[model samples]
Target: MKWSEISIHTTNEAIEPISNILHEAGASGVVIEDPFELSKERVDRFGEIYQLNPDDYPDEGVIIKAYIPINSFLGETVEEIKDAINNLILFNIDIGKNSVTISEVNEEEWATAWKKYYNPVKISERFTIVPTWEDYTPVSSDELIIELDPGMAFGTGTHPTTVMCVQALERTVKKGDECIDVGTGTGVLSIAAAMLGSSKVTALDLDEVAVHSAILNIKLNKVNDVVSVAQNNLLDGISEQVDIVVANILAEVILRFTDDVAKVVKPGGYFIASGIIGQKKQQVKEAIEQVDFTIQETLVMEDWVAFIARKN
Candidate 1:
């Protein structure tokens, strides 16, 4: 079988939404080749460092590659994807170079290509996201390990947005606190909340695929007992008040749901909003603040921003 690799040269801020676009286009696997990875600092706690080729990465910006079976619908799918990415400008998202290229590879190469793109990544002080197939040993007594499969198409939960969210969780989630994880993707945040000693976590996603992937990942990390997975649009119809509300979704989506989040988060609780580009950071902050959330902290990684807001 042959697979067409769709590669896009985009900005760091566009990685999450663009990866999502490729996944929705029926891409079997997605690989991110960011030059930043070559020079990013690591703790080296586990002696973990991947041997990467310089030629594989873009000189600037990021190259997002996804594999799709070479089917009759390939052309239409690519067009739809291109349209979807271009539409990102409507939300003030910078699509960067926006140049896309395609190439063909056999099935054997597809499997090997995407595998090396994932590894055990320690995202925060307490949380380390490890691929299910990777062998890793904890470097600290209090370390939390999250196992994820990128083939699930929700991501490995190692992106800057996710990393900032988990780090915000580390500072915000109190032991035995009730929490809600909006747009729960691979359920990584929900799992992290559960492991952080949250008594109960309600994981919600509008996409059925996300709900399914989150369920499998929650169970894989053995957090199904404390985390309840559900397919719901944002926090609609969810009346449970919790100590924290964490969402790693597009900034536009976050702006749309600030009122809903404000209503569901108990007074003085925390709301962690991520997957925002630098361009929309202030706008999102203002939207949430209008709903009674006071910005507590602003976290910026590369060009992505995550906000930690406390309900007044």
Candidate 2:
């Protein structure tokens, strides 16, 4: 089988949204080549090795690449992805140099090409994301490992937004707490919640593909007994109150259904909201406050922000 490689040249601010667009358009695997990573300072507290190639990245801006089967509908799908990306402008997102290109490759090339970008990285104090293909040894007795295949899902459990959410979960999730993970993606946060001692976890995602992926991942990490993966849109009709809720989604989506989130969270429970850009931090914070959630803490990494809010 052959695959089409769709590449988009955009800014860092547009990475999350544009990658999401590609995923929604039936792209199975997405790779981000950000030039900023070449010069960025990283503090690796837990001895994890990183293999980066300066030649693989662009000179400026970020390039997002996704692989989709070269099927009859590939043209239509690509056009829809472009339209969806253009729509991000309505949210006041800067999509600098939104140039898109396409190329073709064999299935073998597509299958192994993106693996080079993923490695074992300690994203939080206790949790480290290790791709299934890598052999990594834990550096600490208390270190937790999350094995992810990533596949074609939007979340690698390694993105800064996801990293912040898992880190916040490490700090907030108590033993035997009931947790709800909205837009669970790869179910990384739900697995983290379960690993952190949440007795029961509900992992929700509107995308059926994501639901399937999450279920597989939850099983892969042996957390299926504690985590349940389901296809649901945000927090819409969820009536059962949970002890904690975590959402690593776009800030605009958070603003749309924060009230619903507030409804499902038990009193004094915590809400960990992430996938917010730095520029939209205040807006998301104000929206969460409007839903009667008191901001407990705000975490920022690079240009992304995560908020831990509590219901009073």
**Judged by lDDT against the true structure, how good is candidate 2?**
0.90
Off by over 4 Å in 1: 4-51, 55-104, 107-112
Model 1, span 147-175: residue lDDT tens: 99755447678778998999999999889
Q: Residue 221, candidate 2: how far off, in angstroms?
A: 1.0
Task: Report the C-alpha lDDT of model 2 over 46-133, residue by residue, as the tens digit.
Answer: 5665867899899989999998889999989988988988999999999999999999999988768778878888988899998888
Every candidate's lDDT? 0.89, 0.90
Compare the candidates by TM-score and give the number of the best one: 2
TM-score of each: 0.75, 0.77
lDDT of 1: 0.89
- The TM-score between candidate 2 and the true structure equals 0.77
Task: State how far residue 106 of model 2 sits from its true place (Å).
Answer: 0.5
Clashes of 1: 0
